[model samples]
Target: MLVVDDNSNPFEMSCAIEIFGLARPELGRELYDFRLCAAEPETRMRDGFFTLTGVAGPEAAESADTLIVPNRPDTHVPRSQRVLDVIRRAHARGARLVGFCSGAFTLAEAGLLDGRRAACHWMWADAFRARFPRVRLEADVLFVDDGDILTASGSASALDLGLHLVRRDHGAEIANHVSRRLVFAAHRDGGQRQFVERPVPAVPDESLGPLLAWAQERLGEPLTVSGLAARAAVSPATLHRRFRNQLGTTPLAWLTGERVALACRLIERGEERLDVVAARSGLGTAANLRARLRRETGLSPSAYRKRFGAGPAQPTAAGGSGP
Candidate 1:
């Protein structure tokens, strides 16, 4: 992995390092040869005034099978030509490139994201779309995996994308194992939004916690937007507005995501009958589940199961086991 730094959010940088760098080799399926590469030899991060020790610099990127650009401090900083050149060269060599959060701006500046769909922090979605209008932007998604290039939405979505890379490289089992080790859910359905409507408060405000908990416990039941709105004691329009403001999506979209996530769990556990999976996920029928999955991921439910449900230890971009 090649982690580019521009003195951005050290917390996100550290999250990548801890998950992909400091993860226990003994616990991990195999030792990961991860590197913290940069445009400069030595970079100073904001965390603890810690000056990161020098690595091999941009030249080190040449040997990497995958490159990761972490979130930058400023999204508007013009990428140096030298930095863009390294990224383009590495990409030309078939190396998989990942841009987490605002790091997508770097890849966009390098021109790798031209005509490609990408994921960026939704708060800056309009600016990114206006700046790179040629690039197809998927705002409602947590990430976009376009062939050799992958980009993640803001914040924790990076973890989801990172784990996805691991699953792709090794297998689902290993990815799940590593995720368990990290205390994060192994999968968060790639189709899920980067931020949900009515997220639980940061300081345990619990204003929407009870409602979310109640909804989660009954995903298999019919969940209409009006019904959900009623549970929150608000009109459907009010609920809709709240959903947009908090989660960046509608209630129906959020419910479908939860159902899809449930279906993934079922398939991973070896439920092959499409009807059974659909019913369990509250997607109603096989056709509905198939349509939703295809719309969300451009893949059929069966294909997804074949690729991700069969194995655990596969090699992914995150350096865990997956394929």
Candidate 2:
């Protein structure tokens, strides 16, 4: 994988290098062969305070299986044709293309995202729309995975996409292991919103913080709106209003999401029996777990476990343990 650096954000660059470039021998497989690339003579990031040298040129990307554009020089500033040509050549040769944040601008400018479902930071939706009307932008998403092409909204979404690629190539187990190594969620669907906090009030603004924690530990128990509100010492409607204002989502939706997240962890830990996984994750029945997993991850219990399950933790659904 080659990460194309074009006078951009250091944080986004670090996000990629940390996930794809760093070695994780603990996973027992060589994952990505990540590298950095520069198409020109001037080698400084966007701020010009951080200087990058010894970066490989475009020719290096030609052989890589994947190519990434971390960000554009600026959404409004035009890129040199020479750089665009190199990026196009990389795509033409069958390398997977990735663009995150304003990097989508580079893809759009190159005409790659034209008519394709793509994403960029939501705040840039209007600018992106005005600049590249041909692109079918899904601005609300955390990222977009269009087979050969992948794009992310911004910030941690960059990590989500990198981990997503890891999951794509090596399966969920390896991705989860790498995610655990980096302390990140192994998967956050591209359809999820880019930001939840509207700002003047924080997510912690007397916002069901304790109730959420309480519900997390008791997902197996029946959780109701009234029960949750009672525990928080507020009326159900007040709880709903507060959740909407502070979390940007409802309590039930948040609870279900948390349950799905827990199921992911249980599955990743390689629990063999679907029923056991279902029981412990508090989704109850295997059928219910199946339904929820598909809704959340677009994968079945067996399939999700297969992609993400790890270690000699439990007996196989068909029969025996890994060891």
Candidate 3:
């Protein structure tokens, strides 16, 4: 992985370094051969915060399997032609590309995102659309994963997209490990809204943290929207509104997503019987598990297991063979 630094924002650049560049000794292996390269020998950071020096030159992007483009504070300023040319060449060579915040502008300027779906800071939604009418800009979502090209919306969402890329490349368990190290959520679906209308309610609302924890602990108990509402001492309608406002999703969608995640973890832990895994995860039947897992993970249960399963099945709590 190579970070193409051209007046990059420190937060987003640091996110890429933390997620992909840092060594994961706990996982007992290096995740990537990470490097930082710039078009100039000494590039100034965003807002003239500091000078970045001693990094590789633009040519280093040629050998990288993945290239992370720069996102600067001034979106109006055009990127250097040399940087754009490097991005175009990297894409042409089939290297994966990432854009954090206004970095989408860099990719679009290079003509790589002409017909691709992407995301950028919500504040720049109008400018991004007006300038690059050809690209499909999803300003509402935290990130857009359009195959080889991925773009993240705000500074923090860069971490979300980075974790997602980690999940895609190394699977759920490893991604969870990385998230744990960062003290962040293991997963936040790309479809979730990037901007919540009231990030903090004008009047303090009851936090759903305890309720969510309760639901997660009981994911295998055939949970439902109404049931969760009742548990939270609220009506179903109120629950739905709260979910939309606070979680950026409906209650049912959150429940389903949790169950699917539980199902994936089970598979990773060597669950072999689809029916048992489904029932334990509250997905009900093997068929339902298959559909949900594939929809969420882009891989069937067997395929996911083959890719992420730890080892042979161990004994179950009931003194029987593991699922």
Candidate 4:
């Protein structure tokens, strides 16, 4: 992987560095070989707060299997033609090109995003639309995965897309390992709309907050929307509207997702008993668990465990902060 930078945001760059740069021998082998490069050497980053030196030149991107363009300094102002030239050349070689945050503009400039759907920070939506009318700009989504050419929104969401890449390359278990190591929650297939709706930072604490907390605490107990509504002293209809307005999802679907997530967590933790996993996750019988697992993740319980479960004597130290 080649990381292209032009005064890139440190946080966005760190997302790639953490998963690809860091060493994890317990996983058996290196997951990714990463290098840092830019069109100019000793360039400033994060609005000149830091300077990157000793990075390779644009040639590094040509032979790289995956190339990343971190957030650029300005979208309206033109970046060096030399940088755009290298990006266009790399994409022609079928390299997986990713644009993080405003880096979507860099990809757009390179013509990689010309006809493909893309995503970027919502703040830059109008500028991107006005500048590149050809590209299908999805502002509401956290990220857009258009096969090899991927685009992510904002600095923080870059992590989501990076983890998603890991899941796509390896499997859910490995991706979940990376998430556990980073101390971040693993997000599912839905777009970033759910996140945008609740802006109180990680799950809101409004009217249904208490009820949501209660349901999470009792995930093993067969739950219903009406039961949750009664717990909150609201009619079922009112609760339904509240869920739709706040979480952008129906009550039962959200519950099933949570149950599936719990089951996955249990399976990933090396749970041996499938029946226990099903019962504990409130999916009832093993058949139900299998059906739900297959429906949500497209893998049966044992298959998911085999693909993503922890290996023997696996070191727990992999779960921590990245460099």
Q: Of 2 and 3, which scores higher on lDDT?
A: 3
Which window of ten consecutive residues has the lowest lDDT sum in model 1? 314-323
Weakest 10 consecutive residues of candidate 2 by summed lDDT: 314-323
Question: Which one is best on TM-score?
Answer: 3
Ranking by lDDT: 3, 4, 2, 1
Please name the candidate that would achieve the greatest lDDT relative to the true structure: 3
Candidate 4: minimum summed lDDT over ten consecutive residues — where?
314-323
lDDT of 2: 0.74
Please, what is the whole-model Cα lDDT of each candidate in the order they appear? 0.73, 0.74, 0.83, 0.75
Candidate 3 collision pairs? 272-323
Candidate that beats the other on TM-score, 2 or 4, i.e. the better one: 2
Off by over 4 Å in 3: 199-205, 311-323
- All candidates' TM-scores? 0.75, 0.79, 0.92, 0.74
lDDT (Cα, tens digit) per residue for candidate 4, span 1-323: 54556667888877878876777776786566677777777778878888888888777666776788757757777877888887787678767788888989989988888888999988899999999999999998778888788888877788888887776555566777788888875654436452445445333434676787789889999899888888877788977877776766678888887787788878888887988998888888889999999876678877888877776432221112111
The residue-by-residue lDDT of candidate 2 on 1-323, one tens digit each, is 44445577887888878877776666555465667777764567877867787877666666666777648547788876766776787679766788878889988888888889898998899999998998999988789988788899988899988887776565555667888888876656676678765446443546566787689899878888899999988799988877765555678877776677777777787677878877877788889888988876678878877766674322111001000
| Deviating ranges (above 4 Å) for candidate 4 | 25-29, 188-190, 194-221, 230-250, 259-323
| Ranking of predictions according to TM-score | 3, 2, 1, 4
